[model samples]
Target: MKNLGARTGFLITLGLVSLCLAPCQAQTQGSGTKSTTASAIFPNGEKGSAQTFTGTVWVQNLVATDSIYQLASGSVTFEPGARSFWHSHPSGQILLVTDGVGYHQLKGEPRQTIRKGDVVKCPPKIPHWHGASADSPMTHIHIVPNTEKGIVNWLQAVTDAEYHGAR
Candidate 1:
């Protein structure tokens, strides 16, 4: 009787594990016509230019537009005290926080602290900047939808006073 109970418990656990992994497997497998696992992974990102950023920042392109979608996405990493210059997306932007702590601020507004798992939506043409906090490195996935106008409009750099004020 005890052996039967143990076998039942093991089966239940195995079923639960399979259920948990099913979605992941499905995502990689895709439909018979298409494979979703065709996306490329960039381990080391390219350095962000100093002209548009402060300190050290790296960006890795993840997904680029195809015939079906006019969107581009990338993972950006910011070192301590690093940040992007004020900019805006023509069609809007989404930032998905993946690690560490950071800050986001819209023009003329107070800075907001952002941590892992936070999702920030910046409306179309709304000037803003985001970056790692003064003491920590931060990483986020940035999604920008391409519009007829363009993806982004670069603006002035965030002043040192502004960055320090957030801390």
Candidate 2:
């Protein structure tokens, strides 16, 4: 029964993530007579575990690492004030911000505000943390390259003092 409760909570969180990420608008270029928008609505893969994140977070894995591709990718959405634990990738990770506002901080550096259309590069083996700001949710596409060397190294959870310290 305890396990079922936990799963239920995760499902509720997943529902919130889906609601936030499910909206998309079509844009017609030049001619109203043509449906010219080329947009893809990605599948919402899974709910992030409480072990890995605080609050509600969603991940949609789009690519799996293979001999040919050598890269793995997924889209992540953070609910307002939600954030990931301190972690690092072995071969580095790239974040393509797609919506709303967020905060990112490399270990020992100040927090930086991130917004839609921003691209953030997290250097290999460097500890960092990222999440949605207090006032807004955030969504980003994360690309991790060179998986043979390994992927992320999860560290400690970001303390409230650390998260609220964002500038």
Predicted structure with the largest lDDT when compared to the true one: 2
Regions of candidate 1 where Cα sits further than 4 Å from its true position: 1-42
The residue ranges of model 2 lying beyond 4 angstroms of the native Cα positions read: 1-41
Clashing pairs in 2: none
Q: Which pairs of residues collide in candidate 1? A: none
Assess candidate 2 and give its TM-score to the true structure.
0.75
Q: On residues 44-139, what C-alpha lDDT tens digit does candidate 2 reach at each position? A: 458899999999888889898898888999988888899999999999999998877899999999889999899999999999999999878788
Give the alpha-carbon lDDT of every model.
0.84, 0.84
lDDT of 1 at 155: 89
CA shift at 147, candidate 1, in angstroms? 3.5
